[model samples]
Target: MAVAAIAGGTFAFKALDKSVKLVVDGKTQSVSTYASNVEGVLKDANVKVVKRDDLTPKLTAAVADGGTIVLNRARPLAIDIDGVHSKKWVTAYTVEEALSQLGIDGGADVSASRSQRLPLKGASLEVTTPKTVAINVDGQAISVVSTGATVKDVLDAQSISLVEGDFTTPAVDTPVTSGMQVDVTRVRTTTTQEAQPVPYSTSEQPDGTMNKGDKKVVTKGVAGEQVVTYTVTTTNGVVSAKTQVSAQVTVAPVNEVVNVGTKEAPVAAAPAPSGSGAGSSGGGSNAGAIPSSGGLNWPALAQCESSGNPKAVSPAGYMGLYQFDQRTWNANGGSGSPLDASAAQQTAIAQNLYNARGISPWPSCGPKLLS
Candidate 1:
């Protein structure tokens, strides 16, 4: 009986000597034969301790018989929050859980989408707050700004100014967020003047004739003038520039008149016959005394043709009291220059008629015998 009791005791002692296997970061470790939980295994392995250490199955959970223990070492990481960098140690199993433990909420005003995965161990994290702001000037839309600060801070960064008449949607002191919009506008005006050239009237005298330096009222041209109205533009009560919009002529101009004349006189006749017979006494025999028989009345015709003036000329180059052309005078029985008559003009006319027609009658007593 004593021998049987010793064998049973030996079997029980062997079962109690069985040790637990601990696995940490893929590494295997054998714990004390007395280890029966995760805390005992970690204590036996002498693993580093930290504020947010991670353990599989939990620290307070009972250890499985012949099962393994897994421990994850927390790594030191740096974080940059809106340009401010800070160091932190975490081991919450995942990036999201680690951040949560560090007092960072995923639903905060500043957040990152799932696409922006958490950083690796010993990596840095960037936390940003996106802000939106709207700008307006004179009730007009100007610009929209997205930033991570107050409205004034964004405006200063963009080199924008807030004036008396200018305004912001949420007010300059309002906080900024992502997707905010802004607007700005300026009130202005302008002034200007325009000048126009006045037209003048021109007059030309008749061809080959002039007024001989005499001033006439021929279309007296008066100077013309005009005035224009314009709409000026200005900004902030200050005039910028002006332009002419409409124009009109106030008064009409007057035209003057002129007159002209030819300065040359008519040609003179040849000298009369000499002696007493030249002036008078050629009465009843006058008709018969005349030489030419062309049927033309000599005395009455000559007086009428020349208007009783010895000097006369038609525009067609006819000359003398008889108004004889050069060709006709040359064909007569007279001599010397046709235009210059010492006594030749009258004699030429008489001779020409007599030769062309024929003498009708002859006289011996009236106004006679003067060569």
Candidate 2:
């Protein structure tokens, strides 16, 4: 009876024993455990399971004979996709397996080889996917299928260089995306100088030495010269904008000086001979002596009215250096069209008209007579 009890105990022990195949992180090994559940079997084999680890069977499940158990140890991994960085817990042993489990396919560019082993502690990986983008530059449309990480990478691959004033629509540092359009605008800037005329100002001073209606020029006016600098921008070989950046006066204007008469006449010089004098109706007034110097600026008025051309004729039937109409010319002792007379003759008539009108005839050009 004692021998039979020992045999029965041995049978019970054999019945409880289980033969299981244990795979830890892709390494296979056979384990023999007398424990009843999966947890007990793993404990007997000295295999640890963490929350982040992948376990094929539940810990509380009953252990079966000749069963397979898979336990993939989770590892820390740093991943960068198109410049965006992230950390992931992956249960794969190799880079290829990790990518597959992360839903990454073969068309992506990776920093490490697909078959490289993923270390248990940690490993870093950079990924770039193929994208379709249109590049418009230099008046041409270029289509690209690239695996670059950013817009700058794409441009560099195409041998495109950016100058100081050059720019892109989507900045060069921007991440690349599918179906994104990139426009490169070629800019060229230049500074140009141009000469500009500055109108001269007039100033007047009273002089008591001259007669009431007499005037004398003391200084001649000169227009000033200025150099204007412009910032000209050209885009794609076309002028886009021209902005005035600076202006410098190279030559200053010399103001004109004139003396006006403020003295009273000496009793009209005892009413001298009135024969063929100024303002006379004689047909020979062209040879008559008329005072050239006057209260107004006659030369300036002629320059403003007819550009100093004595024979100048206006479309309004006005003629001569003073732009006189026919009726006014006849009233001012002018014969026929003022253009038919000599410059001296025209001047005499103009002086006679000025003595009568007091600079009211040339309304537009009268202001130019100021000192």
**Tens-digit lDDT string for candidate 1 (1-371):** 89999999998877665367777644588775556666766776786545566677777777755867776667676776656689987664455655677877564333434343343356666665444455554445545534445677777877777655455556677656566665444444334445553455656454223212222345666666666667786554556667778877665444444433232212233233221221222221111122222233444333433433233454666554455566666666445443355222453355444445444211322122221
Candidate 2 C-alpha error for residue 39, in Å: 1.3
Q: After TM-score superposition, what is the CA distance of residue 132 in candidate 1 from its true location, in Å?
A: 5.8
* Model 1 misplaced regions, further than 4 Å: 1-14, 17-34, 37-39, 43-47, 51-72, 107-121, 130-371
Worst 10 residues of 2 by lDDT: 267-276
- Count of clashing residue pairs in every prediction: 40, 1
The segments of candidate 2 whose C-alpha lies over 4 angstroms from its true place after superposition are 1-16, 104-106, 159-167, 187-235, 239-371
lDDT of 2 by residue, 43-152 (tens): 99998898998898888888789998898989999999777799999999999999988887678899999999888898999999889989999999999988888899
Using alpha carbons, what is the TM-score of model 1?
0.33
TM-score of each: 0.33, 0.50
